[model samples]
Target: MKPKCISKLKITGTKRILQISLPSRKCKSIRVSPLESRLNTGCANSPKNSSSPLRNEQNNQKFISRYIARVLAKPEFQNKKRPIKTAATHRRTNSDGSKEPLSARNNKLSGGKSSCKNSDSDEKTIKKGLGIPNPDIQKTICRELSKKKLYKTNDTDEIIREKLIEAITLSFKTTNSAPNTSIDFYKLGKQIGNGAFGKVSLAQNRLTGHKVAIKIIDKSFIKDERTRRKIFQEVFIMKKLNHRNIIRLLEVFESNKNVMIVLEYAGGGDLLQIIKARGRLTEDECRGIFYQLIEAVKACHNMGIIHRDIKLDNILLTSDYTDIKLCDFGVSRFAKAGEKVDEQCGTPAYLAPEIIADLGYEPFYVDIWSMGVLLYAMLSASVPFKAKNLHDLHKLILRGKYDVPEYFSAEASDLLNKMLNPVPHMRISLEDMKLHAWYNGFVPENILDLSFNVTRQNEILSKMMSYGFPRDYVIQSLNLKDVNHASATYSLLDLESSYNYT
Candidate 1:
């Protein structure tokens, strides 16, 4: 009385379901119901129950169920194999007393799929596993992780995986490799310099044992949007400038009250301090320092940047005075092609004649003029044009009344004359100045290595010519810094007595 149609059996709760199939030549079960085969063969007949008749219907059903149970109990039926258990069937209880499948729990915690609701438990696990002592930092990490969405089997999952790995590594390193607190990274030393915006302090990195100057700026002092934008621009520009002669901005950290900028320390102080200490530099010393300055300026100009304020105070020297790094890009601006910046900024003595006129001028021309003034101050220990008031100073600069001392060599005086040209169009360009005899084969290593935005350069040059200077003279002056046959160098007394306008 064994049922031949049942090929498989499954139990769920209190019910048992049987899979019916027909036997094939290989003795394997084929899943085809008798009703379907009869319909396909065009036999229009309904299925009939095949059970023994009894006096009571309940008794008959009970007899049929017992008969099937007896067949299932046979040795042949009991020897049949069953399906294997999957990985998801393996469940585990977390330390928090919640039961979850092992696979799902691993995916949730390791894949960063845990939400804010579960962040507390995850943080406990992280702290217990990694031994992180700082509860505040642990909370921070958990909070950041909670903000991320659940991971999926896609690109986002990879990102989440990477973030999880980074968080774990950072936490471990923070606890084991370095100090437990962020403040321990650096030790504050003496106050080095102060300005209207911030104060610079010398600090030593506890881990690397390197000294750096930290510029701490109070956020409250930046009252206006313009000033805030300038601060951002200074940081952005400093980060982009990767030249050896430009001071490196190592890192920037912002908090609720202040913004701290880590910078390379210049132990020898600024050029102004050197000038004040030594009165004037030797020709060889001046040439070496000025060459580095020219290279720095050239690098800035090539990147379409203009340091509106360039002076001795803004130039810094290394401990040995072997090199200089141009710093203080607070007034720097990106001068695009064909653009004429009309901002009347910069030191009065260093300001170009056009800038003093309150008229639009090429910023590169202004930089060159400032460099000329710097060169003069470095060699003569005095500014070329000095007056009691801004009005007299502007007048002197407009009249081209700068003087060259008798001690200056012919090449130095010639370079000064070209750089100090009254007209912005006639001022020698950085390219020609690099080739001047005063430089004496001292070509900048990065001169040709740098790239320029040609469109921006063309725009600036075109706009510069529109400012009342002959186009031909502008081009010629920019190209003729190496030309030996120009004009005789003016003496201090001669320029002081004259009142020329051109």
Candidate 2:
């Protein structure tokens, strides 16, 4: 029998308990790890390391409780060593011939291929003078791992083991403690891009040397609570999404003054720059890009999300220019089938006719309309409807008076007309758009196959624990939706695995 889908699985806390519903086991695994809180989060597949059977509700709750207890207990990280003082400072050459000092812990994490389940669990002794754990020690270690710095890589051997050694020595004194994660952890690089809210910068993880884009939104730039909520909403929606076509939000940190978001580095830049540089692209090339865009939109709509703003500027291309990722969810929101929402937003040129007419519009159809505008712009290098002012633009959009470029083929024109239909009811559905003859020979590459890798999830769970994060912290963070260190590391690890290493 397939793992049954159950609702109301609650993880309780001091304030209130958070609940998550597991999808049916027969359902395909998603791009997200099994431990996430997404719609298709994970199956009820029992943990492989556990011998006790999760055959009923009580057992399932017990598993969650134990997991939570393990994490929330926030136990101090313990390290067991067998006299490696001399070996600690000795630099060893890798097979590649580069030499770097590797700590005993680094060997378990980076040198060897041991799975996380067995990595951090070996018993270690507290020194004769100290047996009681210092409560702050756990936070200090966890904070170091959760910083808003570069996404950590496999360069564990490079981490300053001196502090780790100090902590180990602290085992001899009282419980050991280290500083919380700080900006010092990142090797800051040049500014890369800018947005309405903040500037983007490039940074490399000091340990692994991996590059990441950090978007820092200053509190002063935020005008009001509504704008602040929109930014938070973007983070929320991005967290729920785990598709290849969408940019991964690796980690998030909000301070009293600024909101910092770490994202995948897309060196290829946005679609607007590409469209401007290339001008009018060939029909074949446009179809290729559109395929991915449509797939991204489909993925969002599947999760009942509407990317209220879909335009050339919002589509990000990969460094290789081989793939595109949809981004900028500042105006997105959830909607049900046939549900209508009103709140005139989105770029002027991409607004649907219903929106221009002040009629409450179905969110899905509005997104489809914007996509039509995008497709038109992709083909002609400009929006179909244009005017000197908002009044004139609204008029042109409501009348649907834009002419199809003479260069467009009949099939392309036909599809565009259906998409640009003034009658909202007549707009082509996503299914019809896929079947449209304009894309007769188009094929998408690297199609995502959802296979919930519980092992990978366990591996991450173990890795976090090894770094001093309690397992319960990860689960609780996901449940509470706190965009903090434990959840960030899990998402970062999952994002790393998400990329095609080949």
Candidate 3:
């Protein structure tokens, strides 16, 4: 500064530092060796290090500078440090075959709601916090979580499929593309419900104001060519099927990439949600619902469509509980005129022992097995076999091991045991089921027509939830205002004996 100092710039990578200038204008760069300084300081007791403190400090600085440069110059370590790809950062397909942007639906900062952007900084935080070990279970769980959040409160069509897809992704790898088309087939709205393939969205027909549930499918997940062909086969089967108990397919549209299936919308939700909200059913109410369920299954078998997937979720109520519809033909297989299939498909929990054993059992037998589980769940609010893993579940199913709680009546136990027999030949036929002791008292051979009526159906739902459910569990599950009124389907004085379970 005494004589205007001239500084020279030294460059490292893209960064430049100014070097101090001497009186002669000779610039001297003060470079520090972070590693070398530590090594020299630690080696102070060496014989060659005998020097004055100031001299030693000056020599140590020079040594440290060289050490840092030597370490920095190593190519192997530098080459090994590649950027990592994280699961959370990737875009994944939802259950309904839609690719959702990778971000949480809800974002709030200090109670202020806003769309939060996913950033590298957020990735850094995740890397630091979640030191997830590379184990198979952890990897599987992560893989599922990456596609969609485990649980979501949103009922939006896209988000619902996302959640359901995430739930089942571990077991099933769903595809993520819809049929591409020029025509506006339907405008998808909020999610109506979930099915085996993906989800059903309440879509409006663009041309007409008529509303329909559009089933979305991601083409990428079709996997094998046979599976893809099976999808078309299912569509063909659904086309021919027509009945009151079955949800009808209105139209079919396809683009190069996806198939858009249009189906009638059931305003009321599924039987599972109703039973979950209510709890248990009375004998008459149980009989009523059971009769409808059996009739629906019978109808499918009659049409040569073996409904591979038949559970509480597949049976939906028509606004009023009177009209019940069996849906989700995704897993259904059509047998020849009188032929029965032996495919290992249907849900594990509901799988008949013969199907699990691969013993070439009839498709209708699997339906009966699932019905048994359905009946058990209706009577007791739980499935017959509850195991930790699918293998154990199959073992229990094959062993024909299921415990009917003391709370269940002996008649119910007898019925469940009859239908749940592991041997396909031993299992009771649907026709024989119609004549069971529990249903012996009901009038008119056409129990289905009588049960399908609006007044009788509601009475059954109310009584089943009221009498069958444990009071405390029923109230908690349903969020009921009055437990009594909630269970009250109709006046007991004028009530038909068709609903009395005991």
Write down the TM-score of every candidate. 0.55, 0.62, 0.51
- Candidate 2 Cα outliers beyond 4 Å, as residue runs: 1-182, 446-450, 454-482
Q: Is candidate 2 or candidate 3 better by lDDT?
A: 2
Question: lDDT winner among the candidates?
Answer: 2
Q: How does model 1 fare in lDDT? A: 0.50
lDDT of 3 at 126: 29
lDDT string for model 1 (221-245, tens) is: 7876444545665666665566767
Query: What is the Cα-based TM-score of model 3?
Result: 0.51
State the lDDT of candidate 3 residue by residue for 1-502, as single tens digits: 0011112234332111112121342212111112111110000001111232322223243543454344345453234322211111111111111111111122235553322222211433323222212335433443434444344344554555343333333332232211112223245688754433455577664323345577766566565544454455555556556565677655554444555666666556665555555565455556666776677777777765577556666676554344557776655655533234334454445666655443345546567778887787667666677666655665666667788789877777877876776544445666666677767665423322223355654444454333233334323323421212112212121123332322
Instruction: Give candidate 3 misplaced runs (Cα > 4 Å).
Output: 1-187, 194-198, 205-210, 336-342, 444-502
Considering TM-score, where higher is better, how would the candidates rank from best to worst?
A: 2, 1, 3
lDDT by residue (tens digit), candidate 2, 247-335: 77666655557767766665566656555555655676677677777778888888777776676666776654556678766556656
Consecutive 10-residue window with the lowest summed lDDT within model 3: 38-47
